[model samples]
Target chain A: MRTLVLVFHPDLEGASRANKALVRAARELPDDTVTVRDVYALYPDGVIDVAAEQRLVEAHDRIVMEFPLYWYSAPALLKEWEDKVLAFGWAYGPGGEALAGKEIAVVTTAGGPESEYVEEDGGATMREVLSPYRMMARYTHAVWKEPFVVFESMELSDEALVTTGRKYQAFLTD
Target chain B: MRTLVLVFHPDLEGASRANKALVRAARELPDDTVTVRDVYALYPDGVIDVAAEQRLVEAHDRIVMEFPLYWYSAPALLKEWEDKVLAFGWAYGPGGEALAGKEIAVVTTAGGPESEYVEEDGGATMREVLSPYRMMARYTHAVWKEPFVVFESMELSDEALVTTGRKYQAFLTD
Candidate 1:
């Protein structure tokens, strides 16, 4: 299946390491099968071209949303994409069938460790944190897959990022 | 206690009746006690002023985030505000005591009915969908209150909106 990876990071080259590495790995996939779009680069002004986005999604069988977790969710621009691109008639509601039957996945890197996400640690589990996306996928009739998360991103060494990137590549292709 | 209600509707004056009513009710409060900010109007370009936002939060003992729910979450600009204004060392990590002991509450209106938000209906409950905000409040050392939700917004009559708005005013003050 053709997979489209929409990477949404404000400073992918400057402030990010793990996400960049992951994107690089995703890019290394055979060109015919995977298409990677750096959403922030594409829309620096924060205005999304709804038609273009819908067309891109229609072209792909699997949609992977890659980003760094901000406030336990995707960046604002990504949210903007959802608000603007995923319209009522196009993505859901009465006549919305554009995204139906497509597969949706999330790949996120978090600065905090996995243990910090539990209730005992006073933080929410990844599942609870990502519930909105899950529900959105359901509402859009897209098949939601389990998320791929890179935890404790701040502590990962260069070698560790490469290892995780390799794993991410396998996950995307699998 | 001084209350700051950051209203993040894309268009409060237009395309919104319930939210406008809510804001009007909020305005009826004593001017010295409550500050209502139209966030989207303040930043038409989607750029948030971090320093000003921090100062606004600092000035208030209670913070109420009022918005029309988009895809089961706050609007994109609100997410942008969270990503930018709630920075490291200011909202979390070390020395992030600016919001400590402050009360944080969410007041939202949903186009869908309350029944659509239940697990049996293949959607997330309000608590689960709003978990990220609750966790963010906890992470920032702020007090998290039960969210105030207005359901079936599209069907609410003008009279119903006024009643709901009055209740919203009470909720913010209480």
Candidate 2:
């Protein structure tokens, strides 16, 4: 399956560590089946290319969105991409079955640990935090894959980071 | 309480009907206790003024995030505001208490009806869709008010729109 990874870090070069490592693992896939796009770098000004994005979505069998979960949601660029690129007539609405049979997945890192994302603690679980994305996949008739989440992202050891990368590569090919 | 209503619709003037009415209702308050700012218009280039936004958050007793739900969440600018303005030192971490003891609320309009938000139907409920905001409130030590959601926003009748606006005005204060 051709998998498209849309990385939505505001600054993958300067700020991100987990996302950067994750991208390297994605790039290690030795074929044309995996295409990685740093979405934020492509639109520094935050203006997304709707048609080009639509074409990319159409060409991919599996679409994966990679980002650091900021303030309990994906970065601003991912939302911007949804607001602009996931046009009503193209992604949903009548005759908009572009994602009808595709696989949709999310790979995100959270600075906080798993203990924080619970009802008794933060008013939501990690699964609840990701409900919006799941909703999007359901609305578009796409098959949703269980997300890969890296908790305590700011404190990952060097060894754990490498292990995480290997697991992520497996997730991509799965 | 001094309520800051930050409206995050990309095109509130031309592209939005529900948000336009909601803003008008917010404007109808007899005094200055309710302040409405068109956030998207303020940041046309998507460049948020972090310092300015923090100052505004500090100045208010209640912050109401008003927006049209695009793809099951607030507009991109709201996430941008969180990503940039809600900085580590101010909104969370050691000395971060900008939102502490303050009221954080969301007022959003959904194009779909209330039925679509059910877990059995759309894979999530409306309350689940708003979990991220609740989590943000929890993280920042803020008080999360029950959100005011407008369902079937795109298909509301003229009378229903007016009623929704009037209800929104009341929600701003309560």
Candidate 3:
């Protein structure tokens, strides 16, 4: 299946270690099987080309959104991509079928440890943290995949980063 | 008590109905008690002024983010506000006490009906959908208020819109 990885970090080249490493791993995959797009680099002005994005979505069998969780959500550009690319007539509402039967997945790196996302002690579980994207997939009739999360993203050792990258590569191919 | 209502609608005067009404009602309150700012109008280029926004947050006892729900989240500008304005040293890291002890509330309008958000059959409940903001408040040590939500917002009757606005005004003051 053709996998499209849309990376949505404001600074992939600088100030980001895990996401850049993950992107590098994804890029190492055969071009025919995986296509990686640096979304923020493409839209520095924050204006998304709706037709082009929709076409990319249509072409891919599986869509993976890769980002670092900021304030428990993706960055502004990713949200903008959702608001603009996922248009009413094209993504939902009557006659919207671009995303139907396609698979949607999220791969996020969180700064906090796994324990912080638990249900106990009034904190949100990982499931609840990702519910919005799950619902977004459901809204468009897209098949949702279990998200891949990297906890303690900021403090990962170099060896750990390599392992995580390998795991991400496997996740993409799976 | 001072309240800051940061309205994040892309078009309050043109395309929106519910949010415009809500903002109008909030504006009708005494200036000393409530401060309403049209965030999108303030930053048409999607660039948020972090220092000014920080000053505003510090000055208010309650932060009420009012926005129309797009893709089960606020507009991109709201996410950008969180990223840029809610910085590490100011909002979450050591010595981050700007939002501590303050009240953080979300007042949103959802295009989908209330039934669509129920937890039954894997759909997200209203609480689950708003969990990101809830966690954001916890991260900043702010007190989280029960989110104010208007369901079936796109199709609300004129009278219902007025009622929701009044309820929102009460929510702000209380």
Candidate 3: docking tier: high
Candidate 2: the clashing residue pairs are none
> Which of the CAPRI classes, incorrect, acceptable, medium or high, describes model 1?
high
Write the residue-wise lDDT of candidate 1 on A1-174 in tens digits.
999999999999898899999999999999889999999999999989999999999999999999999888999998899999999888988899988999999999998889888866556789889999999999899999899999999889999999998999888888
The lDDT of each candidate is 0.91, 0.91, 0.93
* lDDT, candidate 3, A28-144, per-residue tens: 999999999999999889999999999999999999999999999999999999999999889998888889999999999999999899877668998898898999999899999
* Candidate 3 lDDT for residue A117: 94
Winner by lDDT between candidate 3 and candidate 1: 3
lDDT of 2 by residue, A51-147 (tens): 9999999999999999999989999999989888888888888998999999999999999889887788447988889999998898899999999
- Deviation (Å) of A157 in candidate 1: 1.7
Best by lDDT: 3
Q: Give a tens-digit lDDT track for model 2, residues B1-174.
A: 999999999999998999999999999986568988999999998899999988888888999999999888998999999889999988999899999999999999998888787878547988888899998898889999999999888999989999998899889877
Best by DockQ: 3
> Between prediction 2 and prediction 3, which has the larger TM-score?
3
Worst 10 residues of 3 chain A by lDDT: A118-127
Tens digits of per-residue lDDT, candidate 3, B13-126, equal 899999999999999999999999999999999888899999999999999999998888899999999999999889988888899999999999998888888888778988
State the fnat of model 2. 0.86
